[model samples]
Target: MRGWRNALMLSLLPVLVSGGLSAAGGPDYPITPVPFTKVRASDGFWAPRLETNRKVTLPANFQKCAETGRISNFAKAAGKMEGKHEGIFFNDSDVFKVAEGAAYTLALSPDPELDAYLDNLIALFAGAQEEDGYLYTARTIDPSRPAPGAGKERWADIKNAHELYNMGHMIEAAVAHHQATGKRQFLDVAVKCADLIDRVFGPGKKYAATGHPELELALAKLYRCTGEKRYLDLAKFFVDQRGNAEHRELYGLYYQDHEPFLQQREAVGHAVRAGYFYSGAADVAALTGNPAYIDAIDRIWENAVTRRMYLTGGIGSKREGEAFGADYELPNATAYCETCAAIANAFWNHRMFLLHGDAKYMDVFERTVYNGYLAGVSLEGDTFFYPNPLSSDGIFPFNHGEPKRSPWFGCSCCPTNVVRFFPSLPGCAYATEKDRIYVGLYFGGTAEVALDGGAVIIAQETRYPWDGAVRLTVTPEHAGEFELRLRIPGWAQGSPVPGDLYTYADPSPAVITL
Candidate 1:
């Protein structure tokens, strides 16, 4: 197994290493995110996490996958090992997510050893794929013993099988790896997998959407990667197919299937699902400039920040389905702020900002970073808190029905999420428009921002989050007039946020400005 991958990497290293495919043009939104590669975050808060994720978290996540049987499942399915699939069916997603994190780490700083490791894993993944690009190990390992929800027939239960969900993560991981390493080895496998999915489901095909709302984002990424129209169409199909009971029963709101996605206004059902769904909708909106899609997510985002979100920017109050409860359903002692939900919230808000160039979106993103999402992982980066409850009494089992922080979980999404998220901090620090650049989040860093005006270098020094003072130094390639927008935190501006969902009071007066 190892020898073949070692040979594979050597064979392809010379031929396929052109940075990556240029993004295909579309009706893209006005705001463009400055890639993390362009921003160098040197802050005490964020820089350490980036370094720690590379040095500790990424390797630890892969180690946990080895221990928990996630990596082995791929081996077993590839016929390189002798064993039944291990852990939950969704376990494959953990490995894919970890791989995605590793790709991000490699982008920051290349590690040949880590790169080779991913090559081996991708070989296992490639071997496990069937002739037609069917790649779920739970079913591929032994069809007769498919995971409980994975019905005997492939995709028999689209609502619970998580077949597409697993593929979504894999595709995203592959795109990240291809972009980071300039290797087409992993990208080939991902293209096969996505192509198979595209053939299996679509307008005239199955017309069914996955229970989980993830493939929406993956297909969008794939579309941008390869400049393929089918992937984009398939992504739109899934978004449009939900709640359409013309051919099958809806999975209901628990899966964001209660009504056609465009018709839905208020955020409802599962929080993580809703978060991913909202982000995917934004992607489609940005790509096609579909007014209905844009208007829909606008209302949905309003509902999320105004009614459903926690003060910490964590979302989903109900533990029953790991979902959002009614408006103002928050209960401090019983809060179920799943770490994955917070990560999804950050992802969604970032996409929202890209869609509208609104500072409010990053305001929420910053809050989640500092509070809800930050609490998910410990400072050392090994232990994890699955839930972010406001207060813990020590007896209520507040943290996802476990202690506040555990080294690992059976459903290891949170830890793996932390691995992928913190490495992306530099991406959140800056964005660009035609003749202007925007500072989305304040971090002491130097960014080489490429804009329509020209290449500009912005340097900043600040304690920010820890202290309020910030100073910036900007230099343009040539003397020119351009706009620079700095996002002012709602709290600092005295509004806290747009709606009356939160407030602040103090006896002592302090002056603040945007």
Candidate 2:
């Protein structure tokens, strides 16, 4: 009842809280991102891709799920089908990620067939859930004969086990589905599962954190979706528990739990995991105005940008553990920059910009969007790359022993993550403060922005990243005196990146016309 969005939801709440919540008022950053739903992209660059993801990629991913047995896992768990659990413990996450992408597609364009498909899928998910609201197909398919990484009990294996990780994707997909369709079926399941998690672990309860950092951000989303303070509290609790040995034994640096979050000044461990944790911390920092969360992510962001990041805006240098290498140790062909890590990096930088209203964050974000994660998906949208490297020999194993992109992989996180990420673009194009509208991203589009005034229509025309010429036409609802903050990219300023790690060779004066 509480989660369904109205026509003015974009005006009411802000955008891309998918990565971080942009809560208004208080000591929180005054700028709020405009939700993609309010901004439509007319630019041919992203339009074709969004349409391709919806038409080609969505059903293709769904077919792959069916063939791979991910779809049937739910049916098997629910007793609707008879079989043992199939695939890896984390396979459920891929399914959820695709579903979240599908929800985003539905928001932009109404698709009855896709809508019905999601509804039926949600039904299977509902059936797969346990009586008390526990949901995990690998275990629920047969509790007595659990799968390899399903854990001894529900919350037993926090390290390699992906129970919380899977549920985190589920919660995120559920929020997207609810926002798109205004149906509570999927959201109800997420709430039930979250409730079970809430009961199992917390302040006086288990005091655990995921070996992977996703549910923390997902919990922030759940809080925003349902307006339940408990979900936000749980998100903060999970972050608070990290590095607190008295609460739980730390998983060490590979999991970014080696030290107290506030004490951590460097970005360490698995790249994707670190990005999500910092993004969640930004969400908490924005919503709660907790300076601790702010300081931790701020420090971590600097350490990453100035040292560990790649020219492509990628991270994670070593294939071993698929983790980050030492600072400034970014290799060439052997680099293991996972596509998911790039997505996480972009997500983190977007949050940082929203938190600080700085163009540097968006600059790094643009580099990732253009060069980093965009390389993960081929033009066809069917093939994908798990590890996006800087250089590759024709015969070398760049992405897990494959030189070129593969149609699919044994671990399909990157493909599914790509599906979920592409549709989040419209929200990134614009943002708002009290009396100002920040054009954070450039694309030819029309955005119906909600100010303290009624609605303002801004039309942007440009062949961006390809052409520098931009034309903006602003029509405010009333003749209000609001400022427009146009972002001047670091690249235009002659710095390829914000930090000293990279720069441009051919420098020229940037031209801007009013």
Candidate 3:
């Protein structure tokens, strides 16, 4: 077995060393950088066009708002006059604010109803933000709160408090807002909130890493967008803090902080939390070039892919703690495949694949994208299932007793989360190396990459996922021969594979010698 493993790795080494795969019958194409183009939903993928599926766009707001009957759920949850649960729900407020703002921006021409509704929602979000840059409706953020157990002890409920989660959402909203337009109104607010959190947590901060997970990934993205070294350093700090032995007990044993994330040797804790933490850690590995962190990621990934992961690429143990159990302990009906967890897993897998150029990561991504992801929202993209239980029978129960969908959920993270992730699908398909561009996924639409000494865009016009065949038309900006690497999906491992201009059966995961 050891020799076989070594031989297998040795055989696959050339493919890794080479750019990846190749285009058609030709010389090994040199990869030239091209301006990455946006994608739109076409063929079998959710989207195939870029810019069209943005979060702040009009269509998404309409879909989410209409699905939920209105964005009034936040106000109700927030309590009109500071009733309770104010700051704890920072995550939802951030999401709602972005949804509303994007809707307002996107509805000018075609979606009048969405336009008006989003305006009202935006106003609500703005009002909710404190002058100190704090924008939480959870009671924990309330200064006038009663002592623990006297009434709603918002501060004491830190375990359930999603302060960092909300901060992460704000960061995401800001990025989306900036992407949609050149304005930085909300982006500024998000930065303020992040700065406040930075001062309180990490190295010299008062608090520690969040048990809920979220802010780390958001912080990393924010750092990337703004080029602020502080943000990047802070994100790295949080990733390192997770699952540390001393810190784990300090936070609480409930979420499996009893051991370190790397030392634990298995995925655990809240499904969404574990996914978010892992995703953030992966980001840390990518940004810092930390081989140790990446090694931990690989170990955890092996367990997940080989044993713990669900067929849908969903990871978790059960509904009890919403945590992961022993390997292969996946119980379909009792599975707590939270929608957000699935989304987070998808996000993490994409990042890993991009960082390492590993086909196994994409294998996980494809499973989650197609199965657990789709189950989150209804076919219409409205309504959601907070818990994506594998098997739904009379005993397990669905919406009430069957697998049903709801426009809005009481806790409600899943509904909005589904909307946010699905719309951002195009950004995850392909990546670039020194001068080589790699086709990691088989989705429709074009990929514009900037690499080598010039730019090259691979325009893909084909129905994919539904069918294995993909039509890739290469257009070089500089009009020169460049190498474009294609991934021979691990699934197409059988003999006499769909060998064509775009694909070929390379059992050893061969590098394309175009």
Candidate 4:
């Protein structure tokens, strides 16, 4: 049994790392997640949604991209077809995000057809790359044409071009593809694009800032996958350069360039951008052992969850810029709780949980997943809500496009983000810290956790959210000692979150066992 478990652990490491659940040695994070492949989601709540994402959601998204010209935009850029760019400058990111979702789905349910479709898509990306290794379909389609906010030349408008943002999603999709399928066709393209970014932006380079903060976290994941020091350095540079007055006078707090990264204490600017920035900073802190980054992110998290967050675990109260307003400014009817922002909140909080192993972070994580984030997509899995308002008037019309969920949007980041995120839910259930195994989320799954002593199989059965009764059975390779900690969610303890902002009227105790 020990040898079999050891072999299983070795085989699952790549899948785990690819799913962003790798427990690779890092600074002071108390627990690291078990891989997605190692955990089987049998719970009533998540299993059906996971299946919907794979069968109904992902396939429908691919068809929508084709009909909406997102996939064709890449072909147009690669000379396989002839047409003007279809949507906004950031439309290319929607394709990459969908591809990422496909990769994660393939990890859970292997499909040859989906894998082949991804390869064809990656081929288009490879063909769309410029001679200099740059890959933005909107710009690469015609270098002489002016982008919406950028000039004709490359890297002209770092403020709104979204070049780095597109690259970030591209790198993320490629890494997931490589990890899930063991294919380097997409990964090679990402590496080339990343190398180009590295060469373009650094000390004494053309730019000293990021238009959006997604690339930082993507580059960090790339570094983790390839063990490339340059990728990590590039991520750090992007995080460090924020709020340095480089672009602050022009963008101000709207772009979160008000001050230095380490000097800022509160979550500001666009909610999605601020959340991605905080998540990336946490990644940098974990990789580099930098206390400043960790401290800054901690303060920002507190500000967000305490002063600015809604009871539904939603943020970004203002509708003007789709941004965060002053503290305690939550308005349910007009709440601009963008789905992307809610998903970003989950991303940041998940990193916080990994960094500190605190149940409070998971409390928020669970809240957003069930309420804010889940509200973005419909039960059928095709229509989407870009802005999830707490209280929607029958006639007031609060969403960006329509009053209710639509099949897609012109800016389809949220829908595609949901596609990529929901399938990875099982990976968040279990984590390991040395000899101790932490069970943060209970969703009726079996987790194969690798520990210092040997491999251990943790089997969990529960009816959660609907009910709090849970049972666990642990089988170690041999009779060895290890600690297993079960987190008690705030809702179960009368508080909605960790703080005094929100509370439940009727609280229930959580039942657990060893």
Candidate 5:
């Protein structure tokens, strides 16, 4: 009977191809095109409503928290710096010092309202910036601002003061805002900052190495958004600078400054930092098509997905380092699935999928989004989860009974991150390549795609995961042969047999002979 089934399957192949498979196509399903003007203006699984709402609300809440001097109180209580290096909150602003988390949030959203807030915040930081673009509130000046005291006189704080992370986040915000809004104010801020970063960190530059690994990716992304070769070179400089020993390296900071990214064999340091660097590496790989860079990414992915990952697809081994632990060392009790780390993981996975066109990467993305990320917000979308744990009983005392969502946190990275990422979901569902359009993920929406022949409106309608049924309808303006490739999720393999049918909108479903 099995032999007969195989023989019958082989025989039906020709007929099936000749018949021209009927697929669901139309404009009902849509995707937010890349280089958007407003975050969450379009909707889909890549971004959902609940998430977008959070993104839009966070900065305002933080600003309110800042203006009322409530933020200062929180900073003092949490041991974070409440002084003048202050612009926006960076995680636990008191304990972690005036750093970059909030600035990073600005990159993710860049909406007009948010942009204005960021402008004010940037002005605050600008007063703190060292004539050049070097800005780190924690290490550069005392708490009061305008020369009460110098920041981090020991050189330890500024050298390791998350200066680069702040700039990187600002760069990201600038690029995203420019793409979404067609405005240059944010981009101009980023460019000025980038020029400062180049002067300070590029070849023969003076800033030493980045204590945090973000600006590299941000520079790469900026390059992609604009056709600026200088941005690309700056990004390359950052990537090449990693892991080098000869540099005026800062010790006992985050990661070792003894080598470069290509030289580093394993993942290390803060989970978010490691993940961000890996993401930057993937961007370089996609842009340059460098096999060595791709090889590094493959190794990093193997290390991350196979060993350092949680069941929820979250990465990081210990709360102590917020870093990588050994293989299979994933413990549920102390799992520090930092909300920012999970968000970074999603960023890496998205870029990897785009670079390789692999569905498995998307699978990881789905896992991270549904489990690791969903835990970041409350059901009402008002609260946030910082350390997403697998089990939250008495054993996991730290995160137990913590509010699902809150108006704010001592370290406010997660809240703002959740808000901005939610609105950008639709842009991730599909990508176009000349004449061939790839349907990466299924979500109900419409996309206007410019193909080789002409523009075609693709409408997709489906309630995925909730239901297996999917329908896609394509309406073309002119007659052309356009290939629409659908994704066959790996999980669908070895499923039960079912009767499925798909229909198309165009009459006279044309037939062709090869």
Candidate 6:
């Protein structure tokens, strides 16, 4: 068995090395993710849901995007179809999220038909892009139809246009496509769009920040993927200019622009926007070693997790603006724990874990993944919940049509986010900190971890979140000293988290590892 494992590890080394597990300029953290393709989940809790996402959820979403005029809007913008913009200005992002989800699914399970479909969609995007690489279908399709509550001129309404947000998703989807397929067809388009954005919004140009805080993270990802310093600079610029009015007019506290990011410590404003901004700041800190970004993110994270979080790992207590309430203001029945907010929280927590390699962050990530985030989608993968309240009254109507999971929503960001997130989960299982590999989550899978010595295959088997007995078999190609660190979840040690916000009424029996 040992010889066979060694052979298997040797055979997979080339593939793992070529997959680009480490980020450009090396990750600032000690840990880095093992690529998704190298870790294959077995028959376990997440396997079925991952399968359903690939077979049922994504295809249905693609069809829905086609039927709902999202695809045709692109065609119309390209002059291939004649129709007005069908949905909101940000509707273009939904399509990109679906594409990203499909790319993640393809990384695990390749399908020729799905690949062909994505190729066709990329062609549509290519057609829709303007001469200088701008690609907002709502504005490109008909410049006469102004964005809701905004002007017709480009960049006129930075607070509501969502143009930057749309491009952010597009860049993310393009990078995912490139990573999954090793094809640059879509990546080239994203590069052009990003270049145009860089040219338009900088020191001497029309200095501006996105109303929605997603482009910073996207630019960070693009920079990491392409090793381009300008993208990283742009990302840092966005973070630095958050509260500076010279960049753009402040949209008030509701938009998280009341104070500079480094000065603000509480998690405020729209829940999703706040989470994305923090996550982007975390990324910038990782890349640039900016002490201000790191300090702000740590303080903000502590505030959110300790004072503003629910027992179910949910956030955003108020329904009025879908925003976070004051400290200890968590309401159970009327809690507005938007699904996207929970997802964003998970994203931020994961970045925190990457930055610090702390078990507390993984505990939060695991808790949110198993609870609030999973609650966003139905078991059958067809319906979704937009706001997942901790306790429901069975009468208080929530946003997105119904209190229960619904087939779709007028604003379908949550569902598409669910689609994009669930399939990329395997990448979070393990991280390599030089020669030492850390096991973060215990899913039954095989991870090919790249280390300074060589490739190590860690085969994990367990019934986690149900049973706590995990057996990890480590096989290295050549015998070289390396450490395997296993995270002991806070729950198993008789605490909910490393904070005073919540605690178990009684401690359960501690996990006994023989």
lDDT tens readout by residue for model 1, 1-514: 0001111121122111111122676666557788888888898988887888898888899999999899999999999999888999889999999999999988989789998999999999999989999889999999888866677799888888889999999999999999998999888888999999988898778879778989999989999998998888888888888788998889998898999888998899888888888888888888877789989989988988898888988899988888998888888766888899999999999987877766788888889888988888888888898877777877776665565588898888899989988777788888766555678788888999886557989998999779988888888897666667777677776656557788777523246543
Instruction: Report the candidate with higher lDDT, 4 versus 5.
Output: 4
Taking the tens digit of each residue's C-alpha lDDT, what string does model 5 give over 1-514?
0001111121222111011111111111112123221122233543455444545445455664566453453343233444443444332222111113333344454456755654554444444445555544444444333222233342234344565676787677666655644666657667777887666556765545566777778888677666666777787776776665565554432563445667556666688888887888776665665668877777778677766788676877688877777766788878888887888898888777666655567667766877888788765566777787677664434543453445566556676677556655555666544345556666666777776578777776777767766677778789867666565553453211111111223333223211
- In angstroms, how far off is 406's CA in candidate 4? 0.9
Model 4 agreement with the true structure over 1-514: per-residue lDDT tens digits: 0000121232232111111233243433445778887888887888888888888889988898899989998898899998788788888899999999999999988998988999999999999988788999888777777446544678777778898999999999999999999999999999999999999888778545677889999998898888788888899998888877553344568777788889888889899999898898898888877778878888888989999998878889999888999988998889999999999999999888888777788888889889999999888899898888889766666666578888888788999999999877778877776665667787887889988778999888888878888778878997766666677666665677877777656655434332
Query: Roughly what TM-score does model 6 have, to 2 decimal places?
Result: 0.94
**How well does candidate 2 match the true structure in TM-score terms?**
0.94
Model 5 off-target regions past 4 Å?
A: 1-56, 63-131, 137-159, 250-259, 394-397, 400-405, 494-514
Q: Model 2 scores what on Cα lDDT?
A: 0.85
TM per candidate comes to: 0.94, 0.94, 0.78, 0.93, 0.75, 0.94
Per-residue lDDT tens digits of candidate 6, residues 374-398?
9988889988889988887677667
**RMSD vs true structure, all candidates:** 9.2, 5.4, 7.8, 5.4, 10.2, 5.1
Candidates 1 and 6: which is better by lDDT?
Answer: 6
Expressed as tens digits, the lDDT of each residue in 1-514 for candidate 2 is 1111122223343332223333322234456778888988888787788778877777888889999999999999989999899999989999999999999989989989989999999999999999999888989999988899888777789788888899999999999999998999999999999999899889888888778899998998888777788888898888887788996688999999998887989999999999898888888888788778888899889989999999999999888878888889899888888999999999899988878777899888999989888899988899899998788778886766679988888889999999989887779888877756788788888999898876889999999868988788988888756667777777776788877898667766366444
> Backbone clash tally for model 1?
0
TM-score of candidate 3 on Cα atoms, chains taken together: 0.78
| TM-score, cand. 4 vs. native | 0.93
Which model is ahead, 3 or 5, in terms of TM-score? 3
